[model samples]
Target: MDVLQIVAIGLMATVLIGVLKSQRPELAVLLSVAVGVILFLLVLGKIGSIVDIITDLATRAGISMVYLGTIMKIIGIAYIAEFGAQICRDAGEGAVATKIEFAAKILIMVLAVPIVVAVLQSLLKLLG
Candidate 1:
């Protein structure tokens, strides 16, 4: 959307890094991380709006709310997992990142079981 705004933010972050390096290097790292996090939050806000639209459309289409909710939950899991994994990686904890990803996938599968069961039931009814 606003590529210029993103680029400006990137440039501002780069400048901040340069300034922080000379004055307070320790704080500079934290400041850089904070800036990145702020940008990430902005992007996530946009994504949330998109998800809300999808949920609304699903509701209007007479889809099962449980299924729509499950899909949204899956999206949440993916986002949170990515966020946690990124932070872990940034902190030099690759093992922890892997664990986060594994947990996310397992939870997603668990949440999907109901939808899978519903599909199977529909198939069986068709066959009958």
Candidate 2:
């Protein structure tokens, strides 16, 4: 879908959420979640194409697929964590959102270990 369509969906959702907040707070939260999911689904196709382009570029550069894959995983973790945190915030759970962010950071660090090891190994070889 186009940007205009996404903007329209967001505007409609915002209107509905504002109206429902006074009368049906729970429904307002649900509407927010639904809108977020729909928007994410709409952009999935674009994400796939971007991934393909990145992979192609990595191949042309003769970069190790392992490094490219780790980078992709890190990006995925960041996006997913942000999405979860936003949903938590929308539902008025700021504490939960903070926890989600903390966990995502740890996971990202774990994923970077391999890349760090490779760099360290290269440096050690140069010193020797």
Candidate 3:
């Protein structure tokens, strides 16, 4: 199965991290981050395809590309934030991971303001 590949890579990395944790703690952290990135990259192609499909549908539905772009940025921020948080957690820094997540959520809220405004305008127009 396609998912098996991800599992295999994850298992291998887990083993390596365990082995290196005692001898080289720093390298273990690095290896964890590198493996995380590699896994993300492996599925990056699917992400591109999803973006294309969403773009096409948005175009057909008369949705503004500006909104789509904003949404995309929000999603990117979320994924990156999660990735960073996971790395921090793996390095035994739970506090740092929580901070990273908090920052990402704030950023997401900021980015969402435009879309929220646009939606409110549409609703107001409908009521009037």
Q: Compared to the true structure, candidate 2 yields what TM-score?
A: 0.93
Q: What 10-residue stretch in candidate 3 is worst by lDDT?
A: 40-49
Per-residue CA lDDT of model 3 for 1-128, tens digit only, reads: 75899999999999999999999999999999889888988898888889999999999999999999999999999999999998899889999999999999999999999999989999999999
Clash pairs, candidate 3, are none
Off by over 4 Å in 2: none
What lDDT does candidate 1 reach at residue 87? 61
lDDT of each: 0.85, 0.95, 0.94
Model 1 global lDDT (CA atoms, 0 to 1)? 0.85
**Winner by TM-score:** 2
Weakest lDDT window of 10 consecutive positions for candidate 1: 84-93
C-alpha RMSD between model 1 and the true structure = 3.4
Please give the lDDT score at residue 127 for candidate 3: 100
**Over the full model, what C-alpha lDDT does candidate 3 score relative to the true structure?**
0.94
Root-mean-square deviation (CA) per prediction: 3.4, 1.3, 1.7
